[model samples]
Target: MAHANTVLINALRRTANKLSSGTSYQWGHMGSCNCGNLAQELTLLSKAEIHEFAMAGRGDWREQVEEFCPASGLPMDLLIAEMLKNGLTTTDLQHLEKLSDRKILAGIPSEIRSKMKYNSREDVILYLSTWANLLEDELLEAAPSLESLLKWEEPIPIPEDILL
Candidate 1:
């Protein structure tokens, strides 16, 4: 699950980097950019500060993107949506739209799926629906801490009371 989270984080970072390039505003500012002030609001760091830390004269955008990912615990679809808001091309939008339906339903262990009552087709659909709505609400809130980001990766048994 940590691996999956890492993959999702990397995807979001890539999307953010792509969106950042097309915007006219500086990294930290609120408007005229896809992710609100996310680039700026994070770490309370100035543009120069973030540049010094992430860029470090390497000049690789991918590295910078990785640095940004841990700050946003969001899964990739919401990240992609935020990027699209900044002006993703149609092809990019199509790619991102596909992700929304895929991530929650992809490759879970049957044990875990069964726990969610997702043993059948209809259950999986409902799981996806709930996950989508939960993600929408989750993303609009503040960026999560790295620990919170990691916590979601843990596989634990749900109490019977909670399951019902």
Candidate 2:
């Protein structure tokens, strides 16, 4: 499991919560789709705002990702930049939008590993939760050890009477 930043984990959780709680999900709509939800979480933009930005571009999420230019000041590009800042790469966003990232899928349980349709809300939730778990595992692995925690210089001495 690769280490993922807290920002990424929090965003994934927020997206999943929104999805599971009946936030509007329209796969055909740019703002309500998979990538859009993630954009919402990372960029703090509404679905309508994301849709408006996407409309300024030439294609859907996949195409937009393909043509992403960090230098371009388009809203969609700006949204992508926000996601990137939160630790997602362009490839990560692309895979997320396409529901085709092998690494994320590999972490999912085999029983539920069937092909995931890009527009399915349930699948999106599954994907987000799985990704969050992977990130959480990485965080656990990188956590400071007890020895490290106890290594402060000039540590306070315990009272001898307390030992009794």
Candidate 1 residue-wise lDDT, 1-164, digit = tens: 11113223433454344344442433232221222223333233344444444333232323233333433543332333344344333342232222223444454445755454312323433443444344444454546777787786668888999878
- Candidate 1 regions exceeding 4 Å error are 1-37, 65-134, 138-164
Model 2 TM-score (2 dp): 0.86
What 10-residue stretch in candidate 2 is worst by lDDT? 1-10
| TM-score list, all predictions | 0.23, 0.86
Residues 11-96, candidate 2: write the lDDT tens digits.
89989999999998998899989988888888888999999999999799888888998899887888887888888888887777
Cα misplacement distance, residue 105 of candidate 1 (Å): 17
What are the runs in model 2 whose C-alpha is more than 4 Å off? 1-3, 152-164
Model 1: ten consecutive residues of lowest lDDT: 28-37
Give candidate 1's error at residue 97 in angstroms. 16
State which candidate has the highest lDDT. Answer: 2
